[model samples]
Target: MQITDFSVDQNLKELTEHRTVVLPVACYVTTISENINGYIPLHWHDELQFIHVVKGTANFQINEEPVAIREGEGLFINSGCLHMAKDENSTGCVYICLNVSPNFVVSHELFTTFVSPYIQATNLQYLHLVPKDAWASNILESIRTIEQYIHQSQPFYEIEVSIELTSIWKNLVKNGIQLEFKERETLKNQRMKRMLNWIHQHYAEKILLEDIALAGQLSRSECCRYFKRYLNKSPLNYVTDYRIQKSQILLQQPQYSVTDVAYQVGFNSTSYFIEKFRKAMNMTPFEYKKYRN
Candidate 1:
């Protein structure tokens, strides 16, 4: 089943539980599309997540960095990371998201030794798995094999899945993704989370740099630097892009005029809104609405 809603307080979501008595596995595979809520909201979970782009492109916001995982590519999200995924280009995308329980690998020392550093370290928030890269190719193959085994459920399927997952970890270690932890990373993550939530809450209003800085308990200059470092964009730039994204949803409704949708999403000028929308989407609002319909 696809998860459509997430709790905003802790932003912690629980994965689907399998009905296994002896060898319990908390892994789940699901496809996301417009049929099942167009996008996955920003949320975090204690378990690690693997996203395989099977059919189309997936735009992932891991922490605050925007990443695009195209078809045949994949990404690994560390445990307890703030993340969300949506269809890129609004073409509609389908992908497999697997959430694995950390407990499942606790008994395996090999897996823990190779993977724990990347998983547990707050700095190593996520890893993008590209099929063209040697090590990442191996890891993606392992994930595909595991997905097949879980669905096929052949004899000794559990054993097969476990072995494949181990292979993935081995390749991950070889790729040098494992790194030492920084003690300050945890605090940085908390501050980012607070600022992100505040942006999401008030993006439709007229917000200032001072308001955003205060949300993270930082100075205005620090707030600008923080977003630039992590998201590679200024705070206002992110807000503008977010407004454009939100406008896409509103535009799908035939009754809403382009001007009305623009203002509703916090854009003061309709012409300016159209310009930004065109730059980001490469199409005018009317053209986009017709295409989407």
Candidate 2:
């Protein structure tokens, strides 16, 4: 599906229009809606983003690193990072997103004068993910500076804001750790890879455990044992979960009826799809569509 038609992209555009992309200069506020679960469906951007969880809590999967951001905390997402955000059941979330275009930042005088001193020794390409311990104080301090600029907005407060933003990236790369995807369990090493690969390739197709076991080169019983140990769910359950995720996009789309969506996501029976969707999403297909609207 074209991502431009997707809700996340629309939300990002909305934020951009509102001047939340960056602080007080080229930045725009994409959104500040309440009662929203932070689970923004996946999207990408050329500009880098620093996502602050100002209120409530959020769980995110940043390319397989399962990290949680709490109130007053935030994440330093790299440029072009494929990330997903979901705030769990609780009060609504409000995030202050600071978007920075790397191209503009690097070419601008601000980067060459003040920022060049930091990246001089480093060869960092990806956006740095700032873990809590890695310059946590600096991260919090920068958020404060941004908040001050946002609230005060005095003459050229933007320049002060820019300095804080630069400090975040510079200190992050200087002190932040490069995080890779969490390693698969040692016990199910090979089998897990096969199953994950299969799921990724065929999430939209009807999947079965026997097929998964065969692909993983394990007997059904062994597959059941090792798969759950590593992935924390049964093979069939995992596939159902993936299908429900596909159903979410269809639900969000103005086109596609519930039945069409069900079948499109690989379910054969509408009743079964409704039941599964309700069980997974806590809302039936029809209700989900209405909610999206």
TM-score of each model, in listed order = 0.66, 0.58
| TM-score, predicted candidate 1 vs. hidden true structure | 0.66
Q: Model 2, range 200-240, lDDT digits (tens) per residue? A: 57766778888888878889998887656544568888678
Residue runs of model 2 more than 4 Å from their true location after superposition: 1-38, 42-47, 80-82, 89-91, 104-135, 147-161, 174-239, 252-256, 290-293
Count clashes in each candidate, considering only residues at least 3 apart in sequence or on different chains: 0, 15
Candidate 1 residue-wise lDDT at 293: 75
Residue 137, candidate 1: alpha-carbon lDDT = 90
**RMSD of candidate 2 to the true fold?**
7.6
The best candidate in terms of lDDT: 1
Please give the lDDT score for candidate 2. Answer: 0.60
Give the Å error, residue 200, model 1.
0.4
